[model samples]
Target chain A: MASSSEPSALPTLLVFRVRELRFLAALRERYRVLDFFTSGSPLAAFLAAAAGGADPPRALVTVGGDSVRVDAALLDAVPSLRFVHSTGAGLDHIDLGECARRGVGVASSGTVYSTDVADHAVGLLVDVLRRVSAADRFVRRGLWPLHGDYPLGSKLGGKRVGIIGLGNIGTLIAKRLAAFGCVICYSSRKPKESVSYWYFPSVHDLASESDVLVVACALTRETRHIVNKDVLAALGKDGVVVNIGRGPNIDEAELVAALKEGRIAGASLDVFDKEPKVPAELFSMDNVVLTHHVAVFTTESRSDLRDVTISNLEAFFAGRPLLNPVLHS
Target chain B: MASSSEPSALPTLLVFRVRELRFLAALRERYRVLDFFTSGSPLAAFLAAAAGGADPPRALVTVGGDSVRVDAALLDAVPSLRFVHSTGAGLDHIDLGECARRGVGVASSGTVYSTDVADHAVGLLVDVLRRVSAADRFVRRGLWPLHGDYPLGSKLGGKRVGIIGLGNIGTLIAKRLAAFGCVICYSSRKPKESVSYWYFPSVHDLASESDVLVVACALTRETRHIVNKDVLAALGKDGVVVNIGRGPNIDEAELVAALKEGRIAGASLDVFDKEPKVPAELFSMDNVVLTHHVAVFTTESRSDLRDVTISNLEAFFAGRPLLNPVLHS
Candidate 1:
């Protein structure tokens, strides 16, 4: 850590780009944020200048979902980097193994987006069960008068909801749905103690018992295509699925096929295997409710993320333990 | 009351039309439902036949939102009718005062739809605040790739939610939202003791202090158009309005203008001033969500309504009090 003797001169922070200027200004109060993307110079020239600076940046700040790949090659360019801070909960874009090997500390915006994501999950579930978006479309196209009464939707009360990954976001989803009188069960890497919710060891088992299957687990090698054909089949023809986690958490092709064949009653998806490119088949299906990957993009959550990122940076520079450190692999 | 000498013969139930045959079948086990619309004979002939029958229909069963107007003229035609059973909530089409004057007992599907409507209210609120329906439209139009990020939405937690009525449905909505960490306030005809939620005497004052205003009151002469221009103005530009109550409870014209002028952030309306008719202005606005008055039409709720209606009829015929009597003036 830098000595306290020169308290007036703030530490340098290397950033690729920032979405919010206010957040940048907040960070600038405590650090000299060197933004490579915003600086009016060639990329090679900026990197060369940054490499040759008198005080090399020791901390790198990044926003999640920016497709910012922080691998060994990028780390090699910034040899002085000792800490990586992500302004979002997702660590998919960050090379955690590389950071662990390099002895770099990692801090994430822990649980800041959890509530928003959980709320969106519940919203999507309710939309699917209540046919909110479909009914909206029916009303928008002036179909209500043409078609007398809109079809009856299913109720959320008494539904058996199976949540995949009973983590921070999933736990909150369970809590909110419980208040709506939904029966909650979950499948996770391991059964958590002290939690009274029923637990299933496998995703298929959980799906077979649930009227609604919610995917809220993080995307990983083992969890890829976690909700595949078998899980969808188990969920049955009357079951619905809601995905708020990473897109690849469920097999997009399988999900599309299941919905098309009426193997599943409906689906409400916020993420796709390849985002920004959803299957065209889902567009016309009234049973499906589709949204962009925005389960966490809320104003309040973004501000909370900004504060968390800044706090992590302050703690690192102040020689204190990071508030939310990602453990080494 | 008829003696139970003929055990196989069912009590006669008068009806105009039945939307759900399942509900009709459920009621058929207990009562002989006389169908006027489906009888293949003219209405006048059916009524004349029924009036001349030895066992004239003594109870009238109706479905809510069917706009089945039961007026004094209709009641006078069936002089033997002693009970009017609504298979759904909302007695808007039925003249309660006339029924009271005629000494006709009224039984509604009381509290059977309370949970479903409450769930829908919260669903609409979440959809509005999070822009779920709008985001779905954006994704369906294949704009996610063209537009890198959808706009951020507001969080439900920490927002002040004001309910128009603290009755069964409204109170359930408060309980569900309270679990989401929202602060709850309410406005009703009278403040009940032993309740802890903050109470506002008037809806205008409630709107002034709330971030989200939910219309959950019943439709009555005094409650009609309760949320007018002043209430909309008090809700302000950032406030959202979610109406799961009757449509006339709000001024639809003022609501449309307020939304057009950005007087309020957004609205999610399940009921309209006119059934099957919505303002064309709301069709293009992404800030609003419109549904076809389906807050209480869930399959589970409908089944519950059938049970409640049957129970009420059975109780009335067995010389006991109606299960859910709507006390009249």
Candidate 2:
């Protein structure tokens, strides 16, 4: 929506596959809008819509659907695109090199979901460490073991936390866990200059050392299955694994096997390789906690995210710097 | 239990109930111990054991049992009693008037379970507020909603927390939740001499004004069922209830009806009126997160509690004052 006093010189925005529709709708006055509804195949339809228009939109915003290959086609269709905003946090889509070579700026929602993801990480940590989810089930089932003369439970404080990919969300998680009195350490490609956490140069060293290993890094060719069989074996019997970044970072099959064999204590996952297709084995296990990919959908965050996206778009159209520009790999 | 160099004046404990038995057995040293073996009349068995002893110890310790009311019988049996220690935090079980009148010093475990109970409160808050158990079960049962869309969850930050009692565990919970950026208000019989918190003179006033109502007060004649139907109703539809103190504080049937009819959002409970006898109606509900009163059984707290209890016993036997002396109620 444009301000009445200052008529928006905003270029039209062709937002396709926007999961947060209400957020974008609030920005209608600020830009000449064209929302095309397409679930997985927005490329063909988006081209048709752009061609029929009087002038193509200077920018396009879409969610990550089919890998970065799909984004290559999107870049070709919108040649006049000066800026492309990926609605997702991880830029696993949107071929960064294609945009970089074309001088087309790309922006992603970076720190918008940091707080929510951090909260989810802590929730998962406590859920597994405290065995809260199991206790929740036990009480409802009339099977409270502690009350039945068997008391066994643990706390999360004074434990070592190993974070993979000490990015925005990881740092936020470190801060929150620090408040709970956990010893924080991390293993990144390279140590972050800002944090003074104990840095292990490799994932294996981190897995062996940490009492809890949290995956909060980007999903990439290098990171895929970084927490595989060897890593799980390295984590040993008393370690917990919490993943919020992506599913492929930890091999699910290996994780299930590790859990079954007591190679690792437990895991709490928010992101699965296949959405809504978690294994039944994990369902029956006491050591696993799974939440659907709804970490970023808090009521407050939903509204704030929409506003942040609109502000990013406004800056781009007004020749101002974008808030979270996507860096090409 | 005493070391070779230390005096052997420590009390010989006689525990009658399961919780007390577990707590007493955890002591590092072996004091002359007598374990009661009776189902219906544990206190009678405890009295029988105390009477049969050849000589009285320096002190007698009891946890939760009918043994508290049998104090006169115990003092009659053991005329050498200089002190009595209760394993449980509260001293309601001990006949404090008789102890004071008889010149017997009484001690209770103070604040040992504070962090454990507080951690459980935070876990329960997150579990119910985020609807974790419900979401967890949904995914496990292969009943993930077709659209992967469910009820939205709320953030703990910016919410108002009303503490019913501001004693040891309550203060700890306040400090912990404050880290999450919540507004903490409390209601106590006699408000502390110095504390920075919004105070409510009555439970209804606290219920009406807060988003979350937590009951952490001791179960007493005045506090029993204090959070009755009126208090629950005062909390209204969006309020969440968490009880780590005792179940009788809430009228169970009223809480069930309120939750069933959406008069309140949800609740998380640790203690129940009947041990191992949760209501069948609450079994299928996702709004409630139930635990078996094991919040104080964390690994760190358990070890710490043992060390503190033994130290207190040692101190008392060494002609030193009790660390956490229990005053007559």
Candidate 3:
């Protein structure tokens, strides 16, 4: 809990990360902005913010990558900091237990990333199902016959698509696929209510039956390695898998093996365990499509995330309840 | 009209202009087991079919490219020929007016082409908006950091997308774009009553208002060159254009001028005025994406079309009304 500090001081805000310069500039306009930094300088930025003079920020707004144990220590030192708001959908970054013990509030940019993530997921779906990328490459490389000729491309309609999570992004994916006349089934932690889609109780069950399996669930302890070699094998030779969720949810080594051995037809991945340093082996194969963890990076989502972060900071400063509060329990 | 002759006296069905041999083989399963010939010699095939005294096919099926005038003339001599089914969406080849004048019913693969065309349109949308093809090319060619950072990708949401036609393919494209959260408007010869999308009274109006102008309308005297230099200029520098309609619908020469002069941001085209001969200039530009006219060539759509063509043949043999009869007014 924040101590009874002097009431005369203006509230300074720590802008930890943002997608672009405009977001930070916009935040500065509405608040008494202090130090602005990113996760790249985790230790330095934290130490500097903690030792800053009398009017240090009363809240820290973090974005980009996740922070760990080292960040938690610096977070505790700043007695003036009473709340933390993440500029992302996932809450895997902050040390929620310690924050709860210290009576600090946490909020996340939850639904803001939904539309962007859904966009990328659908793009991947269309890419693989239609073989657009491959066919385009073939034609651009001058491989097309003088009289057009090639293997027929696949279609999205009537294909059995299984969604791993039924959260905001997954639900939107289902709605989008429904318009294409696909049979959408889902397997979540708990089946959603008021939906006509068939629900499978487990991931393997979904994999075994679905023509394409999409992972849109969050990363949690229980979800680690949820899509392993066994799941890939269950999906069989004609099945395609796409992971828009966290990388660890899918076993990377298993995925590479499954694709190479033809246990699964193909895969599209937007997240990796070690991002930006995606496995070079994954790139060599034509069956796999790769994207750096940028499924949530779109112009609209970036601005919406900034708005959500700033609004959370405002509510925290005004002592009103924070919107999209991330319960530490 | 086919000359007066007995049904049993008709020759075998001459299959001509089959672009893909696999599609021909698939369709042949429905026809009488007899001698077959390709587009290489329409006269030889027609003579062979006519001389066969028994087990006559009673009609001709043309697949692949436009049916040649020579093939039509040879088939015109067959007295027992009841109808002609072209396994294509467009009727530019079969001379619908001539067929109608001769009292022969003409049927075509109509809505069967929607899935592939819709998929292609979406592919072009993604390619232009996300600049995926360019980015992929950059990554493959190791041309990263030309701008010293990640390539900029546009958001599909909140953009005004104008579709030029509202036919089966255009409506299918509309359904897919609806999920992308885009504001949809379209210009058609006549307004559709089922959809409530904003309608622009003119192509020029649609171009001026749209962030992305898409060509999905048919090619006719009325629509030819509708998206010329003026429409391209109205789209402005930040706008993108995609064409899945026939190549002539856009003035290819003027489009080349607009793209070269940076009148519009970029374009993705699946068809050209002289296909398989895309402008060398378009190949050199980073702002343009090109593909062979394989928009309606997906496996799902191919099989669906094959089934429809077979059904049309069966119905013609049974002397019933054709499902998608194309006729001249």
* Backbone clash count, each prediction separately: 0, 6, 2
**Models, CA RMSD each:** 4.3, 5.2, 5.0
* Total clashes in model 3, counting residue pairs 3 or more apart in sequence or in different chains: 2
Expressed as tens digits, the lDDT of each residue in B227-274 for candidate 1 is 999999999999999999998999999999999999999999999898
Model 2 C-alpha lDDT versus the unseen true structure:
0.76
Specify the CAPRI tier of model 2.
acceptable
TM-score of each: 0.92, 0.86, 0.87
**Candidate 1 whole-model C-alpha lDDT, 0 to 1:** 0.86
Which 10 successive residues of model 2 chain A have the least lDDT summed?
A1-10
Query: Where in model 1 is the C-alpha error above 4 Å?
Result: A1-10, A28-31, A36-49, A52-54, A327-329, B1-10, B27-32, B39-54, B327-329
DockQ comparisons of all candidates to the true complex: 0.80, 0.49, 0.43
Off by over 4 Å in 2: A1-13, A19-58, A64-70, A78-80, A145-151, A189-196, A317-320, A327-329, B1-12, B18-29, B37-42, B56-60, B65-82, B190-195, B316-319, B327-329
Among these predicted structures, which one has the highest lDDT?
Answer: 1
In model 3, what lDDT does residue B141 have?
A: 51
C-alpha lDDT (0 to 100) for residue A43 of candidate 1: 57
Place model 1 in a CAPRI quality band.
Answer: high
Candidate that beats the other on lDDT, 1 or 2, i.e. the better one: 1
Please state the error at residue A55 of candidate 1 in Å.
Answer: 3.8
lDDT (Cα, tens digit) per residue for candidate 2, span B1-329: 11222345445655444344455566425575544533244565546546555544556666642335536767776666777767665565777777888888887888887777887887788778777767777787777646555776677778899999999889888877776667999999977767798999899999999999999998888898888899999999999999988777788889988988999999888877665667778887878888777777677776777777777777777778778877421
